[model samples]
Target: MDPALLKAREAFKKKAFATPVIEAKRPVTSNQESGKESNKKPRKSAPAPVAEKTFDFKKYKPSSNANFACLAKIVKYMKQRYLDGDNEPLTLEDMLDETNQLDLAPRQRQWLATEALKNNPKVDITEDGQKYFYKPTFPLKDKKSLLRLLDKYDQRGQGGIPLEDIQESLPNADRCIKALGEAIIMLTRPTDKKKILYYNDRSIQFKVDDEFQKFWRTAAVDGLDDAKIEEYLEKHGITSMKDVGGKNSTPMQKRKKPTSKKPRNFKKHNEHMGDILQDYNG
Candidate 1:
């Protein structure tokens, strides 16, 4: 081994270079910090997503309102025909042409003439072998006959007749009603909004003031049930008088029918084949 070279390397290591010193950092100024903040802008948030609209694909049905409207037009046409002295029932095509409703779709026209007219109370539909004919529900042919019927109703003391019936029966019904202004009382029923024609008996009727009539009508306890009405009346210092005791009706007893006797069973002289053979031999 070379001892001299090893000793020389150890001596070189012992005379090594001195350690390097680190430099201190300078402090940041307020102006530099403000400048840095000003250079950087605030980030914006992303916008919310919008919902997509969907279409409704439900199947639509044919409305009865359109059918009734068409039926009304046809009825008006029928009334006009009756006025023109045509008592005969009109065919489907004839009615459509006369009412200027020929432009309606074939299916709609067919439905209007058949089902709509048949179901309507104001219309009378009749079939002639292959095709249908439509007419107003007229029990009588003329205005005179309608007046006679009304007079009959008045004589019978039957409360009143429906004006709708007369309208459906007679032509120029409005004119007839107007002509009978003083002779009849036209009333509207609250339940169904139906117009009723009451025969005004001049002998029994006396004129009442319009103001008094209005007051009476406005004082009605509308939209109240019987219990609520009673409560309201009592609250307003008005109470209905209690009913007095009356004799109660006795319930009738059901009568029983007498029992029928059953028929007696008689013995047969020759019930078996051997007995029948002996009888034959005798």
Candidate 2:
């Protein structure tokens, strides 16, 4: 044995005698040791309240169909006449004649007139003794401008001739100098209420109210005739006359038949058909 080997054996034997250590687990606590718990289960949240909606029954109700059939017929006739290039405004008499021909009742006729007039502002009613007449308020070409003028006048609240006011209201005095002068003359002179005066700008204002009546009376005294009225309207470039039923012609003429031909062509057609049938048979 060597001295180094003896020392190594002694060191191995001493290191083989090392000890092992273990730690103990702690005890669990009961409910009494911890805070007390409630027996009741937590309440579930209530569902959010739903909002109630409101509805209006009136909004769903059907509207009245008053005068619908008559209105339709009038509209159809007017449209046909319009498309045929008849630019003349339909008179009340013309409309009444058409209604009567269609066998519409008096009430229905009135309703039709109201409806037509509502659609066409150019249609107006005038009185001649016990009779009523319808005349065109605007020309076919100037309908839009005429409507605009009607709206403008209605908005301005100036129904009567506002000659001085209109002249003063003009934007350009230099450009409208001649028109202003003419308006002054018209204001001073008498003219029919049915006669309209159109400005260069296409705005229309009628001669109305007591002042206009006074003017007409004075013109009548001065022997003013239809030709003079026409000349005045021409000077102002007025394209249409409204409420001219009794004013346009004499009472007798207004009462006279609008058409010279017989009522429709019923007899002529029957005769023509008879001749054709005879020829065919022969």
Candidate 3:
């Protein structure tokens, strides 16, 4: 470096840049100024947000609500069939008789019939003109439930109460029966057979299988329920729930829920790792 240039640079840096000062009329000591500042009221910070107390009012278990809606509609159709006559079920052509005003398309009718048959065994689908379903309405829902109800209200000699009265009381009768894959046997039939009548003498009954009842009773259980469910699995030749596929299914891969109060991943690291700063490239 040139001595003159270095000297000039140092001199320029050391040069004082001064401006005229205008002081306040009353000047106080550092302590007095600080004291005065301290005396002034401190600013109030924003109030902390009040957390809302959340309440869970939901009672129903998680289910396919859309499927339930469709089921309800199908149930309504079944009830209508029962009301019409406990004789021959409606034909494909006769399906839209009541709702003919809705002007349903062919595809729509097919879809509805398909859904109705899926959950309902009582619904019989056969092709005539178009592929149509025969949904016969039953007097009650599940065979066991119907049997119990009948036993409760049976008049012995007079058989059961009027069939119309039972039909009126049981709105979801046919749907329940269909869902359970059970049948209702007409205990009393007109001697004429061809003649349809809802006389007080008419009685109904169901044959609820023991195996089905046991299976249904233990349906809502984990695979770990070895006592009852294991027997069922063995009888049906089912090794795992994964083998049985349906709407309400048990997932094979069970993962633990992630929690907020833990260090994620592994915490421990290699002790002999070299200094990180030495390897810096980026």
Which model scores highest in lDDT? 1
Give the higher-lDDT candidate: 1 or 2: 1
Worst 10 residues of 3 by lDDT: 192-201
lDDT accuracy of residue 87 in candidate 3: 30
RMSD vs true structure, all candidates: 19.3, 28.1, 38.3
TM-score, candidate 3, is 0.23
Residue lDDT tens for model 1, 1-282 = 699999998887766644456899899999999999999999999988988967433433357787778878987777666656675776778788878888776667767755776776655655453333435554765556666777778889887788877776676788877876677788899999998887776787688999999998888787876667667767888754223324458999999876997798988864567644644464
Which digits, one per residue and each the tens of the lDDT, describe model 2 over residues 56-153? 54344322354565455555565445434453455656654766555544555554555545555423344532223222332323334333554455
Residue 260 CA error for candidate 2 (Å)? 95
Question: What are the clashing pairs of model 1?
Answer: none
Misplaced by over 4 Å in model 2 are 1-66, 89-93, 96-101, 114-282
**Number of the top candidate by TM-score?**
1
Ranking by TM-score: 1, 3, 2
